[model samples]
Target: MIYAYIAVMAITTYLVRALPLTIFRGKITNKYIRSFLKYVPCACLSAMIFPSILFATNHIISGAVGLLVAILFALRNKSLVIVAASSCVAVYVTELLMTLI
Candidate 1:
């Protein structure tokens, strides 16, 4: 019974995802649609990042500090690596300070 349920779920998932590509193979010529699709990655990335960053450390203060540092680096148009490292460093330092205090 469990095997049957797993098989059914796998088939349904595959069909749901594969059917879209099979149906929409042609170029999407609509400018608005194309523009929307182009920004999807950024939207998706933000959706994935925000929640985890909000609660990444033992204290909320560390998380907030990390987020602020990350935003500052991003606003300055720093490289992705630099932004990430700065955020990590901020979080670590904040957490360490919280521990000492």
Candidate 2:
């Protein structure tokens, strides 16, 4: 049963990712679509980061600290790897301290 579920999930994931390329192979030439495609990674990255910073257990303090570091990293033109890693480390350290008392 578990193997069947895993197989289904794997197939579904592959199909969803492949469907767009297969359908749009030689047909995607709109300027707006091209511009939007360029921003997809940034939009997805923000979507993944914002909620965790805003709603974590410590709320204001944790959120502020993480947001500050993230902004600094962004302003300095740091790589995504550094920005994500630093923010995660800050959040983890903040959470650990919050739980200690």
Candidate 3:
């Protein structure tokens, strides 16, 4: 039963990916549709990242510091590696200080 469900899910996922490229041979021309599609990944990523980020550390201040650092890096148009590393550093430093205080 689990194998059957997995097979069905695999086929559905495959079709979702394959059908779009196969059907949309021409470049998408609608500006609004293109704009919406462009932001989808960002929206999806934020939805996935935000709640986990907030609750990740035992100390709320640590998470907030990390989140603030990440936002600053993003606003400055830093690369992903920079944003991620800086956020981790911010969280670690904040948590370390929190433990001592």
Which candidate tops lDDT? 1
Candidate 2 residue lDDT tens string, 1-101:
99999999999999999998888778568999988999999999889877666776465677777887878997999999999788877877877888885
Ranking under lDDT, best-scoring first? 1, 3, 2
CA lDDT of 82 in candidate 3? 100
- What candidate 1 gets wrong by more than 4 Å, as runs, is 1-23
In model 2, which residue pairs have backbone atoms overlapping below 3 Å? none
**Residue 25 miss distance in model 3 (angstroms):** 2.8
Q: Residue by residue across 1-101, what tens digits does model 1's lDDT show? A: 99999999999999999998999999999999999999999999999878787787888888989999999999999999999999999999988988889
The backbone clash count of each candidate, in order, is 0, 0, 0
Off by over 4 Å in 3: 1-12
Q: Tell me the tens digit of each residue's lDDT in model 3 across 1-101.
A: 99999999999999999998899888788999999989999999989888787799877778889999999999999999999999999999998888899
Whole-model Cα lDDT of every candidate shown, in order: 0.93, 0.82, 0.92
TM-score-sorted candidate list, best first: 1, 2, 3
Q: Kindly provide the TM-score of model 1 when superposed on the true structure, using C-alpha atoms.
A: 0.71
- TM-score for each predicted model, relative to the true structure: 0.71, 0.69, 0.63
For candidate 3, what is the total of clashing residue pairs? 0
Cα deviation at 59, candidate 1, in Å, is: 1.9
